[model samples]
Target: MSTKKVSIGAKPTNKPATPTADAWVENRTAADAHETMKRLTIDVPESLHRAIKSQCAMRGTKIADEVRELLLQKYGNH
Candidate 1:
């Protein structure tokens, strides 16, 4: 399986302005507004739950992140 490279806590760079900076800010704000998180609860079999817990423990990630990644991969980003 391929792994994604993520910068867990990278700082944003302070760079010189470009002509499209205003548009970039507007678009990013709009995207952020629409991307708010919501809570979800689901019931799964005990074995499946154990597997999820095991995978998360091995990878040093939470079950929620793993579930979200799997869902986003199986279904198109909505």
Candidate 2:
């Protein structure tokens, strides 16, 4: 599938531009997730659920890693 920006009504943009001299990006560490992990709720067929679990075990990682990889791939962060 292809994606293009589309505006149904009036489109909006920033009216003011700031000086680029002060622009900077910050570095951050990954979250501490071993002791406390994130949870998700999704519906899937029984066979698909078993397949996903088996894949995770075969890859020697948790379901969460598979989920994170998937979400990052979709959302442009990894």
Candidate 3:
């Protein structure tokens, strides 16, 4: 049997350092400047939701993004 000592409070050496607070805030500000976003919710059947999720995954897209594009296509001018 082999035993290794570990420190509970020690940070992992292999991981990259996290972004500074200033950098994160700057990035978030830049993103928010492009658009103000709102949330929409609708009830969906379980099977329909699963199918949509599967299709989005296969197409390398997020379900929300796909829904946004669809909405834009249908009613963007109005």
Candidate with maximal TM-score: 3
- The digit string of per-residue lDDT tens for model 2 on 1-78 reads 999998698787878876463242122234653343334578999999899999989989998678888897899742
Off by over 4 Å in 1: 1-34
Provide the TM-score for each candidate, comma-separated: 0.52, 0.48, 0.55
Evaluate all candidate structures by whole-model CA lDDT and list the values in order. Answer: 0.78, 0.70, 0.79
Question: What is the C-alpha lDDT profile of model 3 across 1-78, one tens digit per residue?
Answer: 999998688675888889997666455532424654555789999999999999999999999888878998999934
Q: Each candidate: how many clashes?
A: 0, 0, 0
- The digit string of per-residue lDDT tens for model 1 on 1-78 reads 999998688786898767596566444532334574555689999999999899899999999778878888999688
Better of 1 and 3 by TM-score: 3
TM-score of 1: 0.52
TM-score result, candidate 2: 0.48
List the candidate 3 regions with Cα displacement exceeding 4 Å.
1-33
RMSD of 1: 16.9
